[model samples]
Target: MKRVSCIDIGTNTALLLIADLDTQEGSIKPVFHKQTIIRLGKNVDEQKIIDHEAMQRLISCMTDYKHISKEHDVQQIIAAGTSALRDAKNRMEIIDEVVRACGIVIKTISGEEEAALTFSGAVAGMEELPETFSVIDIGGGSTEITMGNAQTITGSVSMNIGSVRLTERFFSSQPPSEEEFNAAKEEINRHLTEHLPPFFEAREHVYGVAGTLTTIAAVVSGLEQFDPEKIHNFRLTCEQVGNLLDMFRRQTLNEIMDSGIPEGRADVITMGALILHQFMKLLGTESIRVSIQGLRYGMAWKELQKLVSDGETTNSA
Candidate 1:
């Protein structure tokens, strides 16, 4: 059993997953999984750069992840930066700083690659998923919608509309005003309608991944603490999503935070919910199945395959 560490640095959260890869079984067993919301894309939409304070927060989180990975004796560390880093003008500065501080190199991945990895990770262990379904990853900086089955990806699209970006752009008010909410909804609809392919609407089974969807599932389930087992494969109907959106819309940021939503996510949960709501409406799905497995899991699986392939080549030679 070889321990490998995979880090996914996104706009809102920095995630660390350390797992033991069983080469013979081609499976990854999780040893540790943790997430810290550093808001790396806090103002990237407006400023086009990762802010100084946000970068510091991200580095702090990475330092903690590095310590944890070392404690677990991880053999290989794969760190990836998405959305925020992809859009940041000074991403290299941030990357260089991270390497200098934590000795971890972060790879900035494109949106298409992000979607593919997310799809692979989202369905990795779920045996009940429909043959043809959709996977939606709503991050702080971008939203990736991938349509695929167990075997192959049919089509995918990555849109610039995300929770942090939308919140900053439209919902500046604490609890967004009706006008702001409608404006954000309209914007999300416009992006999906104009950019997403027709196949997205045609998919019958849709699985929601990432923080926004998972957090919403946790809140809706009335959990005092977050639990992945309960959240994974959870189902949320369009009506339920609408109900939650209305519930969130009426509450202030503090109230939402106190109501079991993650500490740093309260301000943007409204916009996050709206993103999910609009997508469900556009796709005409009654509900979405929530999958806790996401990019980090997919990245681990991909890395394991590469390692195994290299080993096989060496043996053959």
Candidate 2:
């Protein structure tokens, strides 16, 4: 039983997954899972660079993850940086700092690769899946829509419309005004309309993964603490998404914080809900099934598969 770790450094948060991978069975037994919101994409959209404060926060978070991985004696760590890093002008500074400090190389993955990995991870552990489906991963700086089946990915697109980017661009006041909400919704709809139709032609079932969807599931379930089991595979209807969007839009940041929306996410969850809502409306889907599995899971699975393949080749030779 070998333990491997995977880290997904996104625009909004950094997530780490440490698991005992059973190569023979192709199963992953989770050992530790944690996420920290470092706002790594802060100002990246407007300034085109990672801010100094945000970089420090990300470094601290990665350092902590490194310590935890060491504690678990992880044999390998695969870290991938997404939208924020890809967009930032000064990304190499953060990458250099991370390697110098934590001894982990950060791979800045392209949008297509991100979508492919997400598609693989989102469908890996599921007991049931449609013959054809879509996986929508909404991150902080970008949204990845991947359509494929159990075996291969056919069409995938990553758009620049995300919760943080949308909120920063549209929401000007506390508890955004109706005009602001409408404006944001329209912008998101426009982006999806342009990019998502090709993938939606034949895909019927859409599964929503990543923080935004999971947080909505937690708040909707009214759980005092986050629960992956309850969130995973939970079906959310278009009407429910609309109702939640309305409910969240009226509440101030403090109110949302008080309502058990995860800390550091209260400000952007409303926009996130809106993104999900607009995506469903564009695709004409009535509901989306949420999955806890995401990029980190997909990375870990890929690594394990490679190891399995290497072993088989050596044994045959």
Candidate 1 clashing pairs? none
Off by over 4 Å in 2: 201-203, 312-317
- The lDDT of each candidate is 0.88, 0.88
lDDT (tens digit, per residue) of candidate 2 on 1-317: 57888999998989999987777777777899999999998878888899889989988998999999999999898999999999999899889998998888999999999999998998787876788899999999999999888888889999998888878889986599999989998899889889977877644698888999999888888889998889989988888889988889999998988988877898899999999998888789888889998999899888878878877323210
TM-score of 1: 0.96
> Any residue pairs clashing in model 2, and if so which?
none
What are the models' TM-scores?
Answer: 0.96, 0.96
Error in Å for residue 63 of model 1: 0.9
Please report the TM-score between candidate 2 and the true structure: 0.96
Candidate 1 RMSD to the correct structure: 2.5
